[model samples]
Each structure stands twice: as structure tokens, then as C-alpha cells.
Target: MIRIATPDDVPVIHTLIRELAEYEKALEEARATPEQLHEALFGENPAAYAHIAQDDATGEPVGFSVWFLNFSTWRGVHGIYLEDLYVRPSARGGGHGRALLTELARICVDRGYQRLEWSVLNWNRPAIGFYESLGARPQDEWTVYRLTDEALESLGKRG
Candidate 1:
């Protein structure tokens, strides 16, 4: 079963985040605290929303997907930007990931979202294939950009 995550699930979500980071060989970058998650998901102004999938019989969480709303200037409609999707290795192949994606897609369709977007690591071939199997195409024309804390600080001092 998949449902919106609650405050009590923060710890499990954090654990899964770490596990996913480890799988992606980026564990060093996974340093989210429960407080951070709490504020991001449930604070007065939320930054994102999370959905967790649980075992129907055991009630143990098996996977989760986090997303946030984005506005597309071209489409002039709100869309969903999937930030993360993680399924425990042991719990994979149980259709958890597919189910989660289907649920998110349903939300987009129901709400008239013009697009749903996410980025996959170039080396993650399995994920790329899986997304392709779902009829998702890579947007080759665009490149993603980010500014880290040090970069932001430097920009502030550049004046």
C-alpha cells in the first residue's frame, strides 16, 4: 500500500535515504536530519511532500518517493518535480517503484499537471532503462545546474 507519509515516518525515511545514498555510492552527501525532513515536509511552508509504500501484510515501509510542485513557463501549468525515489534493495522487484510512479502520475493527470520531471545519474543505466520502458524520454537539450553553499557564498561576495 502506498500513502502520504506522516510525521512518524521521518526516521524510516531518513534511513531509506541513507540506504539509497549508499547504493548510489554517495553516502557522504546524505546528511539529512529528522528535523530537516520535518521542516521540509510538515512545516508551515513545506518544501516537498513524500509518499511511502508499505508491505500490505507486514505494514513495514518498503520504499518512498518525494516530490514538489513546479511551474512551467511554457506550459503555463503546475507540474511535479520528483526529487527522490528509493526502494530498499531487499524490497525491490516487488513492484513498489512502479506503483509509486503510477500513483504520482495519477496525481499529475488528475490535477492537470503539464509535465513531470526528474534527473537520473548518467551512469545509472538500469534506472534509465526502467524510465524508458515507462515511455519517458530524456530531454537532451537541457543541462541541470546547481549552486552549492560555497558557490552561493562566493556569489554574494562577488559584488
Candidate 2:
């Protein structure tokens, strides 16, 4: 069963975030705190939303997806930018990941959004195959860039 996440699920969500980070070999870099999650998801203003997938019989959450809306200037419409989608290591092949993505697609269709997109690590072959099987194509022509920490702060100071 897939359902929207609530504030009460912050702790579990944080755990999942850590688990995902560990799997991606970035556990030491995972800095999401429960307080930050609570404020981001349930405070006066929300920056993102999440959906949780639970085992129907055990009622235990098996996976989750965090996402937010982003604008595509060329498309001139908003699209769903999935930030993280993770299934517990023990829960692979249970369809939780697919179900979470399917529901997100449904939301896009229902809301008339132009697209649903996310990034995967270049080394994750299994994930790349999974996404390809789902008819997702990589944007080879486009390069992704980011500025963080000192660079991000310095840029802000420049303005």
C-alpha cells in the first residue's frame, strides 16, 4: 500500500534517508535531521512532499519517495522532480519502488504536469536498467551542475 507521508513519519523517513545514503556510499555525508525534515515537510511552508509504501500484511513501511515541483522554463509548466526513491535492502523485488513511481506518475497525470523526472548515480547499473525498462531515457545532451558550500555562499555574497 502506498500513501502520502505525514509529520509523524519523520523519524522513519530520516532512517530511510540514512539507509539510502549508506547504500550510495555516502553515509558519512548524510546530514538530514529529523527536526529539519519536520520543518520542511510540516512547517508553515513546505519544500517537498513524500510518499510511503507499506507492506500490506505487516503494515511496515518498505520504501519511500521524496519529491517536489520544479519549473521547466522551456516547457513553461511545472514538473515533478523526484529527489529520492529508496526501498529497503530486504524489500527488493516486492514492487514497492515501482508502485511509488507509478503513483507519482498518476499524480502527474491527474494534475496535468508535463513530466516526472529524477537523477540516478552513474555507477548504479541496476537502477539505470530499471529506469530504462520503465521507458525513461537519459538526457545525454544536458549536463547537470551544482554549487554548494563555499561556492554557493560566495555566489550569494556576490549579489
Candidate 3:
């Protein structure tokens, strides 16, 4: 069962985030505090949203998706940018990942959005194949970039 996250789920979500980071070999980068996550997901003016996937029989959360809306100038419609998606190792092969993605695709279709997209690490063959099996083709022509920490602050000072 998948449901929108609530304030009470922040700790679980935070745990999942750390678990994912560890899986990706970047646990040090998973720095969001549970309090920060709570604010981001359930704050007064939240721009982020999350969905929790539960074990149907046990009602225990096993995975989650964190996303936010981004506007495409060409499409002129808001599309969901899936920031993170994680399923616990113990819950692998239970269809939790697909369920989470399908829910997002449903939301996009229902809302008339033109696209549903997210990035996958090039080295994650399992994930790449999973996405391909779902008929998702990679946009190989594009490259992703980011500015954080000092560079971000430096630019902010410029602005």
C-alpha cells in the first residue's frame, strides 16, 4: 500500500534516505535531519512531497519517494521531479519500486503532464534495466549538473 507521507513518517523517511545513500555508497551525503525532513515534507509552505510504501500485511513502511513539481517552459505544464526513490534491501523484488513510479506516472497522466522523468546512475545496471523494461528510454543527449556548498554560496553572494 502506498500513501502520502505524514508528519509521523518523517523518521522512517529519514531512515530510508540514509539507507539509500548507503546503498549508493554516499551515506555521508545524506545529511537531512529528521526535523528538517519534517519541515520540508509537512511545513507551512511545502514544495516537496513524498509517498510511503507499506508492507500490506504488516503495515510497515518499506520504501518511499520524494518529489517536487518543476515547470517546463516548452511543455508549459508542471512535471514531477522525483528527487529520491528508495526501497529497503529486504523489500527488493516485492514490486515496491514499480508501484511508487506507477503512482507518479498516474498522477502525471491524470493531470495532463507531458512527461515523467528522473535520472539513474549510469553504473546501476539493475535500475537501468528495470526502467528500460518499463519502456522508459534514456535521454542520453542530456547531461546533469549541479552547484552546491561553496559554489552555490559563491553564486548567491554574486546575486
The per-prediction tally of clashing pairs is 0, 0, 0
Candidate 2 yields a Cα-based lDDT of 0.93
Provide the lDDT at 4 for model 1.
97
Sort every candidate by lDDT, greatest first: 2, 1, 3
lDDT of candidate 3 over 86-140, digit per residue (tens): 8898997899999999999999999988788888899889888988999999999
Worst 10 residues of 2 by lDDT: 89-98
Candidate 1 Cα outliers beyond 4 Å, as residue runs: none
Positional deviation of residue 74's Cα in model 1 after best superposition, in angstroms: 0.2
C-alpha lDDT values of all predictions: 0.92, 0.93, 0.92
Every model's TM-score = 0.96, 0.96, 0.96
Model 2, 69-105: lDDT tens digits are 9988988888999999999978878999899999999
**How much is 115 displaced in model 3, in angstroms?**
1.6
Query: Candidate 3 local accuracy as lDDT?
Result: 0.92
lDDT for each residue of candidate 1 in 1-159, tens digit (9 for 90 to 100): 899999999999999899889989999998889999999999999999999999888989999999999999999999999999988878878888888999999999999997989999999898898899999999999999998789989998996
